[model samples]
Target: MGKFDDLPETRRRGLERMEQVYGFDMTDGTGDFFRYTADHLFADIWERPGLSDRDRRLLLIGLLSGSGGADVLGIQVPAALAAGELDAEELREIVIFLSHYAGWPNGARINSIVENAVAQASRPPK
Candidate 1:
């Protein structure tokens, strides 16, 4: 059997959910942090039924902006676009809307991240 064959059901579910959310395979990671991320964060939290992925993404964007989590946003912004959870226009609008609450600097940072992700998405495969 391959490495994942022995994984607990939650870990397996989490890895699948991670791929669905991020538009990429996430099975290569190791260690307890990776395990907890996949098992708890993705499986238990993200898989909850009350909110759609887009809704979660929007909430996460606000939290990230408020906390100055630009690096995580760098990953999430692009993944969110790739997953078709948010379009470029909506992302730009988020920048404007969030600017008022998240502060100008955080909004500017988010704007740059969103613009870059949008630009990257528009590029032809090389």
Candidate 2:
């Protein structure tokens, strides 16, 4: 097993969750970026005991919201909800709070993304 496989179960679950949410694969033009993300980002950084998954979810939402990274939120918002890292109401609140700091346009877009994710997450699994 490599470093990715050696990760703790919680970290492993996170990696699998990321792949599921993003449709990540080596052949999808991500290649080393995928491997590095699994190995370094999720397996290493996310596995650290300092922060809870909920905290990481909040931080990621803040960063993505401030940076206008809607593409990322497309995957992350629902996944965060699915993983119990965040709830629909909290997501709405985050958008409202970030609007003041990150600008209205950014927060509005993030709100739209979160709304869509909420809808999708509420659907029954196929």
Candidate 3:
């Protein structure tokens, strides 16, 4: 069995959904990092007691927003949505917070990325 099988039923289901929705396959071309994430991050770290998925997503958003990495923000936004942990408005506020410290160019780029992701999320499912 894969590492995802070790989690509780609900968390296992969630991880499978994440793999499908985000195309996050450890056995894909990428190497150890993906395997680590599959075996440890999701199956172990994120499954830890007392931390809700929403809180983790929010903390990630805070870190990403502060760093102002548009590409990461772009990719992670959908994951946030899929996690059902963060929505558009909270993400908007994250951009606003980033703007203060990360500057206009970075913040604006992140905002655009977030907007695009939110738009994609709103699109009718295929």
Better of 1 and 2 by lDDT: 1
Candidate 3 segments whose C-alpha is farther than 4 A from its true place: 1-30
Residues 1-126 of candidate 3: C-alpha lDDT, one tens digit per residue? 977666656556546645753545533324677656555666567667896767876677667777766667776777777556678888788889878887888888878987887898899999
Question: Candidate 2: TM-score?
Answer: 0.75
| Candidate 1 structure, TM-score to reference | 0.90
* CA shift of 104, model 3, Å: 2.3
Shift of residue 123 alpha carbon in model 3, Å: 2.3
Whole-model Cα lDDT per candidate? 0.90, 0.76, 0.70
Arrange candidates, best TM-score first: 1, 2, 3
Candidate 1 pairs with clashing backbones: none
**TM match of model 3 to true structure:** 0.70
Clashes of each: 0, 0, 0
Best candidate, TM-score-wise?
Answer: 1
Better of 1 and 3 by lDDT: 1
- Predicted candidate 2 versus true structure: per-residue lDDT over 65-95, tens digit per residue: 8898888888778778877778899989988
Q: Any runs in candidate 2 off by more than 4 Å, and if so which?
A: 1-30
Name the candidate that leads on lDDT: 1
